[model samples]
Target: MTAARDDHTRWEELAAGYALSALEPADEEAFLGHLPGCEVCAELIADAREVMAGLASTAPAVEPPASLRDAIVAAATPRAGLPPSPRQPRRRETRRSRYAAVAVVAAVVLIVVLGVWNVALQLQDRGQEHRLAAAERVMACVEQPGCRAIPLAAAKGGQVPVTALVRGREVSLVADGLPPNDTTGTTYVLWQKTGAADPSPVAAFDVTRDGVAVIDAGRLTDPLGTTEWLAVSHETGREPPAAPSEPVALGTVS
Candidate 1:
């Protein structure tokens, strides 16, 4: 029993890492391998997915740069010339060899340029994701019906106030006062309870230095038919136990 409990705890820690996209490739693969058989871990992943969906929804939409598109197209096109390889001896063998060397050099340069361009595209995508997340939080109250806004003040000596919204069938939780997540193996999990039998999962998210996040609470199922409390907990793993540490924010759906 002790060994099983230890394993469960380790798995939970892995679940949290997976939720935050902080797991290394190998660990992520292992976590995925265990996902099919672990209901607790699966629930954690589902909640994390909700948080990711909210983040994606809020990310700013960006169009690809014209130059980037053009460059990509040009790179993909095949040059209608001899392939870059040794050419048979012709009348001017030495000159032909020199030309071939230059061609090879040109191809190498093109490859480098394409690689740099691809990196730039990826960076742009990351920026867009950040912008969109911020925008999504700002627009939450307006976008979903039955959503009411609540201002969460900082605990102490904090500057930013978090704005959260309760809307039809879900809650839009956006905050800017939390500390940046710097730990190598930790993540935040969100939970919702109706003061009934059990607390339901909401989201598992990675908090930024600015403590900004947009948590999504989809339609919840509670015996009490009420959604009243929300909480955040720090844990490791790909899954957390069913219960949260403590209630961070409390409100009602109505």
Candidate 2:
């Protein structure tokens, strides 16, 4: 009984990581080898998956920059004509190395969320210069081969040239004549609809004094063709709601 309990406990530690696709290769192989007849571990994995599915529905999806893909490829590529090392790093350095790796990973995640201007502000200390550079980047996206420029219509009244540049799953919003966020604390939040699923919140932002705002690069929850349209909602707070309040602007994605 004690041996069985210990075995179940060991598998339980790996269940969540495996479900999250975060387990190391050797551990994953062992877990898969042991899982076929292990009812206890199978039940644990199912519970972890259920929790992950629930969390994914509320979170905004983001696509990492192309530079991240290049970095990963360079790291994974083997050195030419070099023999592989037989020895691993010393155990004493493992914890420090792990922490350093985690910090780099966290910074990469921040880059995806903050976009170019904010990343330059945090890392390079260039504010206005980076904002201009980011705006230029948005303009350049329109020249790209497969980019679609979708114009949004004001829900209340008047004609504003609010455009969304969509290429693949990437999206950049450029807006003019949007009503400025006021003392009432209502901010414009972007949302996307794909097929019959509930509209997913994309980002929350405010416009400038001239009623101009640019979301340099965003990512939709679904693939480009699968997404039906995009909308901007006037949300009460900076924090995104589980569902949008009411749309102030709407655009059909084609």
Candidate 3:
């Protein structure tokens, strides 16, 4: 089971093929047999496979044609009719080709990594934009006539202060010392109550790291004059609930 030093280049190519799952049956068998003995090829395969793992999750799904596999096998397979070249020149050429092959694999993996990172950054920027838009809405509501600030009392006598800003049908919440909504399938829900009727769901919101949120609660079932009270509840799901599972704060409409 001795591998000639000169065959390292061929093994490197096979290692890449093994990592990418593109090797022919014979090549795969030979590479597996060689892998336990050759640390260099094992490392190459490990690095390439790590890159392939990331591609599986983030890369768009595309089915390559059957001919593509045939082409790759044909290209990777060394020609049978080649004459033996000078040892010194072949060694030099092999080193260059080996580096080139490794570089290509690295470049492709780099591109995919950058693409995923770029998408994450874009989503973050979009979230910031939404927060800014919500802030602007709160400001707009504040400047409107008939907008009244109502301080919400904590249901359990906690010191966290929550305020409800109401103008006609539009409602916004300004709060401090609220906890983060990290629980799965849960959200902060704003509910409005009129007279003896059950609380009606208004809107859902998210709190920032500073425990503050300027939530634009959309519209109410009744206008500001008719609304009896407003309450914020921590509830499951983004959809408004029929009843509050956990009432965090409440404000009486004056």
Candidate 4:
């Protein structure tokens, strides 16, 4: 057949089928010959090839039954004078059927994987929330023992604020409204007042510019006994000074 140059549009339409190996051998060769020099035709061929590749990868291979092969061969063999056996039912398979199966399977797999990932992420988030709530409850119980709340307002235009819960031997310091400390070389420190005696160091903790910092304030068995004061100080390193130069806030536990 004379290949007409004007038939470029018709060929381009068939390019994808040709690239996917769905077209007859002659047509496939014709499209391939025309593809290299034609940008539009090349894009069509590429798109078709990608779809074909995806289908091939996802489709499950089904072996033709031996009986089906035998039937096909018998039907295809020419009989003397008879019209060449009508094209035997395709025993191998057609690209269209294979791709359809692949599409269904791919969709199912994508849904399952996404569903599982979303569930796992949600569970992880819930677990973290539960842990924080438990910690808050513990703080509330500690504060019930006649503990005093000392507000540590922001210093030097810093918005961060801290509140200390002081009980006899145990004092819990809760920080809120405080800008986070500089992580490079700074930490927040807690101190206890011995009244007539000098101030003693309780514990040290790190604070983010936002968020809360909770510190353990020893064990206070007696709720209404002696006087103990709590304070917050900022410093760097592990060992906090026994005496803080300035206290952000002060409160006494009855």
Q: What is the clash count of model 2?
A: 0
- How close is each model in CA RMSD to the real structure? 22.5, 19.8, 8.5, 15.0
> Which number leads on TM-score?
3
Q: Is candidate 1 or candidate 2 better by TM-score?
A: 2
TM-score of each: 0.38, 0.44, 0.53, 0.39
Candidate 1 weakest lDDT stretch, 10 residues: 61-70
lDDT of 1: 0.54
Each model's lDDT: 0.54, 0.64, 0.70, 0.53
Model 1: lDDT of residue 250:
40
Model 4: per-residue Cα lDDT over 1-254, one tens digit each: 11342255355445534443445567667767877787665655555456545655654423223233233223323346865323323322233323433343334334444565677678777656644753574567656765445555555545535665555556665665455777677767776665576776667677653445465656543332544655667776656765686665555544
Could you tally the backbone clashes for each prediction?
Answer: 17, 0, 0, 12
Model 4 residue runs over 4 Å out of place are 1-145, 156-160, 177-185, 194-196, 219-229, 245-254
Residue-wise C-alpha lDDT for candidate 2, range 108-201, written one tens digit per residue: 4444555644554564444445456546756687688988778788877678446787888778887776767763576778899988899998
Q: Supply the global lDDT for candidate 3.
A: 0.70
Off by over 4 Å in 3: 1-10, 17-32, 39-90, 149-165, 172-189, 194-219, 222-228, 232-242, 248-254
Give the clashing pairs for model 2.
Answer: none
What is the Å distance of residue 194 in model 3 from its true position?
Answer: 4.6
